[model samples]
Target: MTTKEQLTVIRRLMGFAGPYKWFFIWSVVLSATISGINVFLPWLLQTYMDRYLRTSNATIQIMWMFAGFYFGGMLVRAIMQFWQNYSSTMGAEYMLENVRRKLFSQLHAKGMRYFDQTPGGSILSRLMNDTMTFANFWALLNTLILALFAVVSSFIAMYLTDVKVALWTLILVPFLVMTIWYYQHYSSKVYRRMRERLSQLNTKLAEAITGITVIQEFRQEDRTSKRFQKTNQSYYDTRKAMIKTNTLLLSPMINLFYALGTALVLGLFGVRGLHEIVAAGVIYAFITYLNNFYSPMSNMMDSLSDFQNGMVAGSRVLRIVDDQTLAPQQHPVAGATITRGKVEFRHVTFAYDQEHPVLKDVSFVVEPGQTVALVGQTGSGKTSTINVLMRFYEFQSGEVLVDDRDIRDYPAAELRSKLGLVLQEPQLFYGDIQTNIRMYNTAISDEEVRQAARFVQADEFIERLPQGYTTPVLERGTEYSAGERQLITFARTVVTDPKILILDEATANVDTETETMIQTGLNKIQENRTTIAIAHRLSTIQNADQILVLHQGQIVERGTNDELMAQAGYYYDMIQLQNAAHKD
Candidate 1:
């Protein structure tokens, strides 16, 4: 990448360092100070050896002074090192937490389109792995800064002691720099590929774990394992390539340069010593400085890979932060509130892909306190209709109005706050039954949660549990029957008391007994509330105020169930098909 682009990435990542900016600055200052001390220590040793120890009149007091100076320098360096490490670690952790918060907030702000297109595993990788890589970025940056100071300060120290030797050592500097540039140029691409492969591996793993039951039931474990192995092997290949690059360009190449520089200096000092032009003490100090030069060079080469990897990870993280596809949850100004819960879709046309419309010029109205049922085959746009009403997907050329105001104008959070959705497969979180009913909304009281469960008759089964309202729900509520989970879902919806209720195939997974219980709960919640339901069971929605039959993204028929049955249209045919299937 160009220098400008790298700087832009660094600047963006640094923006998250707001909470610990001073800490980071102090850490860098301490690192530079430590490097300066290291550079000075060798010179102090040179002074002591040549000026004091070389004298026949050397005294015990002088020896004590030299020891004191050396020990004092070590003490100061130790103190500074502790503070530097503490500051860098604190800053990095704070920045990482802040970054995670931002990323999670962005994910929540995004519309369903983002979730539909992106895999859950890829998002997980970005959240956990990429954020961790970014955390390492601070340490890599610190190392680079310290290495710069060490190299520059060491060069100055060497030049002061003896210019001729320093000039000769400078000859190897360009070659070392070129080696680093070469490693960085190649390693960046390798690390980028490695990170991408890791994300893919994570994606596969998430899918496998989530669908493990399906895999076992279908007897596809061998197939699944093979697929995972392919991803795993690809990731392994990238790691091997990275290791090879490191072996070739980092420590091994650095050691070679160090050896060559050492040999040339020792030969120069041997000749100079014959004429007593350069002192034994000066030669010793120069050797120490040369080692100091190579130490930072080796460190820089090792950290270059981390720097490049961080850059790649940071770029991925920034993409999500800068995503513009999210619906605005908080508007600059509030829109109209839905006091009566009237919903209307006028000339609605939507397409997940523009080439194939999912809802085409559909129009409907659910008057306040009425239940409208939508019936359709798979891909007949039944769920798509509900998705548009919830403002999950952006429609093309349409007005979805609630209370005579465009839905787009309302803040997303405010709009959703008044709407309650119950999915076909009820989802239960890990929490006590009462907390699940409240969904952790602090505004809900324990009494309110209990009353909502009672209203849905879920209190019957809930009270049977060992802890009753306080019973701990397992992951996804797997310990409960499908019916039990659905009943709790009803309680959850009732507790919210949303102005408008949407039931999307909410009865599809329940048995007859459970369906009866759920239907009773549904009836209670639908009282004096606007509701839209999508159901495949023809009998369940017979009492709907209006029924719309959708086919190929268009409403083929619409009316009260009796009105549509009298017309003998698509709705009538669907009922007949269901009845025939039930009889068989």
Candidate 2:
């Protein structure tokens, strides 16, 4: 990542810590205290060896007092360590929760066009891996703090012991610092590459798993396996390259610093000709302290790669959290109510991409309580029209009005509340049937729930289940058949009692028997509401108040069902084709 990008990501991650300012402060204090205790341990050992060991007044009282101080320090260090872990780890976990929540909200708030442009697996990876990467940043920050304190305090003690020996010991510091800087600069790039490769691997795995049914249907298992193997190999190769470069370039330099420091200490001791300048015990203590200093420095260098990888991930996560939410229109429609369910689209033109207009100069209207059927071939923009009506995608030109007010002047949430949609692919989460039915509305009564279910003909199957409304639905409603899932979704829609109802091929995947049941339920629900149905099968919508035949992003033919049939236009040809196919 570029320096600008890294800084941007860091800023975003830090923003999440705003809620836990006190906890962070406490954690830092505890971390410093523990570091202080660690620094004093070597000095205590030196005192025990040089002073206490050779002293004539070696009383039991003095030994016990020394032991008490040592244990007291150890106890304090242990308590501080506990606080550091609890505060820092909890802070990271809390931040992760907030990040995940915000990401979900932002993703859902985004226009459908955004989802169309992005892949499912790519989004999923960001939610999972990117958040995890940010969490590692907290861990790295704590480690770095401890390492810094130990290095500084140890150096101070070494200097106070003897200036000449300290000077020789300090010779290796510059070289070690330079080597660490170089390692961090180069390894960060390699680690970033590794993270990117891992993300790709995650995306590929998700795709393969989700598309397994399609792969089996097409008998492409061997091909899929080969593709997966290729992705896995690429990930492995990138990781191996990162490890190899780190080992060869970083570890050797680290070992060289240690060797040079040891050589300097011995050479300086001989040059000073002061064998009594620092005691044997003091020399041993210095060596021990030197090891302490080098260990954290080396570990810090080694862990720098993980830290950078996390930083990169944190940057991606922050981008999503920082995205501008779709702001409601400045002038909201005041006290707007659709008493007559009138919808009008005037000169409406829209496109997910600016250069490619999907709907051009489209115009239409539906009278109060009327059912409008939109007929279109695949990719003829039938769904896009519904999307426009729901304001899921903003139009480049034109106005869509519900009743007499423009939709742009309405709060998005308030506007969507009046509409109930049953999509072709019904989604059900992990929960009981009752929870799925109620969804966001908890105050709804059981009578209302049952009535809605009956209105959609879903009560019959729901009652057949062993647990009825209490039956647990697994992820994506895998426990139920496609038709059953559709029925439950239809029930959910009716329970809300939306003013406008949209069925975008709600019965497209069901059997004939299930279709008849759903059609009956739809008839009951649409009696007093504005209904918009999109169907490929013209027969299903033959009785619509108005039928629109869309072709290539334009409504070419539209009228009452009989009027379009009499004209022998696109709808007439399609109905004829379907009838012929069924008979054959």
Candidate 3:
């Protein structure tokens, strides 16, 4: 990146400090102050040696006073160091928290197309690992600033003590600067690769874990392990390259410069003769300052590596924040909220990739308090149609009206508040059954929760559990059977009492008796609501007010079940095929 672009990333990362900026500023000030005091200590040592130790009037009391002050100065610096460390750490953590909060909110605000196009593990890597790198960025920045302050202060002290020796010391400064520049150039490229490899590793691991069941069923553990090893090896190689760069440019190189500068100083003293122009005490002080000076410079070089890593990570984070491709969270034009749950799709067309259409001029309508069933072969655009209605993906060249107003007219939150959705796979959080049903909405009373669960027949199995409604659910509600989990999801949707409901039913995962129970619950929830269902079983949607048969991204037939069956068309053939399959 260009210098200006890198500065822009740094300024944006620093902006995340927000209200805690004072903490970070104070920490820098403290570090510089402590370093300033340290520079003064070497000067004090020189003064003590000249005024007391080398003089004929030197006394025991004077030595005691110097010792007391020396130790006392050390004590103060130690206390200041503690405060500096605390403030810097706290500031970095707070800034990290703020960045993560904003990033997460932005992710949630993005349209479904963003999630569809991105991997879950890549997102997690940015959210977790990259954010952590930003935290280290702040810490390293503070250390670098502190080190620079020490280097400058020590240089000034040395120059004031003896200009000739200081000028000789300056000979090696150019080489040190060049070394740092070279390190940054190569380290930035390596760190960027390392971060990419880390993200790939995370993505591969997440996909493998998510599909663990399928892998086990097929006994493909060996193949999966090899796939993971490929990613792991790539990450390991990048890490090794980073380690090699650090070893070459950081401590060892700085120490070499320190040794060169020290040898030059000793050679100057040897030529001048010890007691001549520069005193022995002054030479001792210069040696001490010379060593002290390189300590922070070396530290600064080490921190530059972290700074590079942070900048790369920060750039990734900023890309997500700056992405403007997603539809805005707020509606551009204000209109009435969805009150009646009426929905209409007028010649709607949509494609994930605009080159290939998923829904082609699809037109449909569901009047208020009516249930519309979508029946289609897989990839026939049933789910795409539902996605359009939810405004999860925008449809091209058509108007999707909710409550007789364009979907674009209402704020996403306001429109979605009136709708409920149940996916094919029901997702439950880590909470008790009651909390899952109410979704932790405080406005829902306990009584309302029980009523909703009872309405959906979820209460029958929930009550049978050891703790009933208070029973704790494991991740995704795995402790419960598929039927039981679906029942809980049913209660979750019914509890909202939404004006519009969408169900993508998966009946294959449950037994016949559980399917009947789910159907009864579905009947209760669809009453007096605008319901749209993607039917997996032909029998479940037989009573829908309107049944739309979809084929190849278009509605092939639209009618009530009896009316469609009477025609003996595509709907009839599907029914006959399903019946035959069931009989066999």
Candidate 4:
């Protein structure tokens, strides 16, 4: 990213701190107060040295009083320091949490095409690692503020003590600025490389884990392991570069200037002493002031690397926040709803990327309480049709109407609540069968859950499992059989009692026995419902009221089952191929 772009990202990240900015403001106040105390302590010691310790009138009582005063100063400084650090840390934490929540919400609001194009690991890395890196940048922010206060206050103190030596110290300011500029220019590129490598490493790791079963089954573990090792090595190389830049450009360089500045202060004072007596307290105060000047600067230098990391991370995270591939929008009118599930697609054309349309001028209508089955080969736009109807993707041109009203005219919730979907692969969360059936909808009582389960015949296998409905599901419910998982999913959908039912090749994965069981449930759920079925098995939808055979991105045949068979077109050929495979 360019320098201007990095600044833009940082500015946007700061916006998330809006609600909790008071904590940071209070911290800034305390930081300034601490800087004041830092100046006061050296002056206090100088006063004691010159006024009491250097004079013959010094007494034990005076020493004790000064010691008590010094101790009190330390105590107050320590307390303010604590609040400064605590408040800044708390503010950073709150900002991190808010940013994470917004990122999660943004991901959910994106269209399916966004997910199709983005890897899960890349998304995970940005959401977790990048946010953490930016949050840690607040430590740099605190250091920067402290440095600002200390540099100014300590310089004024030194200039007040001796104008000539203080003027000489200004000579180093140009060199310091140049060094900082060089370090920032170099380290930003290094951090950007580090961030990219980290994201790639995360992607490799997630892919290996997600497809571990396939890797092991195909005996490709060695290949995956080697690839992962290479990615790890690349990431390690970037870290080594980062460490080299930080070591050379950070604290050591500031300390170098500090050592030079100290030498100059003493040399000037020594020369002055040769001509006339100079108070030891004056020399002591000058050295201490230089220390104060450079110490916070050194810390700020060390945090420069973190600032770069945060800039790069913030840029990546904000990309997701500003993504334009949002879920299809609705133009709903108040009180708009689906009274009857009559679905019609009028010459709809849709594509994921908007360039190569997967659904082209597709038109279909399913009457209320009627079943229409889609039959096609893979990539024949079978799933694409369902995607548009579900409003998961926006069509470029078309009018999809439900109950003769524009699909976009109904509120999104109204559409989702009234349309039921069961996928080929059933998904279950880490919950019991009862909760899964209810889908965490608290309004659904246990009795309703059971009724839905019984309606889908899911209660048979569920009752046999130990603990029945309360049994804990682990790791995506792998403990349950495929048929059992599908049954639970069926119950989940039916419990909502949707007006329209959608089956997306729901029986494609199960065995014949499981298919028989799932078919029984489908039979019960399809009764008196507007149904759109994607038939994976030709025999499954032989009795459909209407059948549509899609080829490429258009419907090649459309008619009742017997009529399509008589035509012996795409539908007839698909059925023949499936029956041939079944006989084998």
lDDT of 4 by residue, 263-309 (tens): 98888888999999888888899899999999999999988889889
**Best-first order by lDDT:** 4, 1, 3, 2
By TM-score, rank the candidates, best first. Answer: 4, 1, 3, 2
Measured on C-alpha atoms, candidate 3 has an lDDT of: 0.87
Residues 249-307, model 1: lDDT tens digits: 98899999999999999998898778876677888899999998889889888888788
- Per-candidate TM-score against the hidden true structure: 0.97, 0.93, 0.96, 0.98
Summarize candidate 3's per-residue lDDT along 82-108 as a digit string, tens digits.
999899999998888888998999898
Q: Which candidate wins on TM-score?
A: 4
lDDT of 4 at 209: 91
Model 2: per-residue lDDT, tens digit, 41-130?
777867877887766555788788878888988888888888888988888788788778878878887766666666677688789987
Task: In model 4, state the lDDT of residue 577.
Answer: 88
User: What is the lDDT, from 0 to 100, of the residue 458 in candidate 2?
Assistant: 88
Q: Report residue 402 deviation for candidate 3 (angstroms).
A: 1.7
In candidate 2, how many Å is residue 329 off? 6.3
Q: Where does model 2 exceed 4 Å of error?
A: 2-5, 47-57, 248-256, 274-277, 322-331
TM-score of 3: 0.96
Q: How displaced is residue 545 in candidate 4, in Å?
A: 0.6
Cα lDDT, all candidates: 0.88, 0.80, 0.87, 0.90
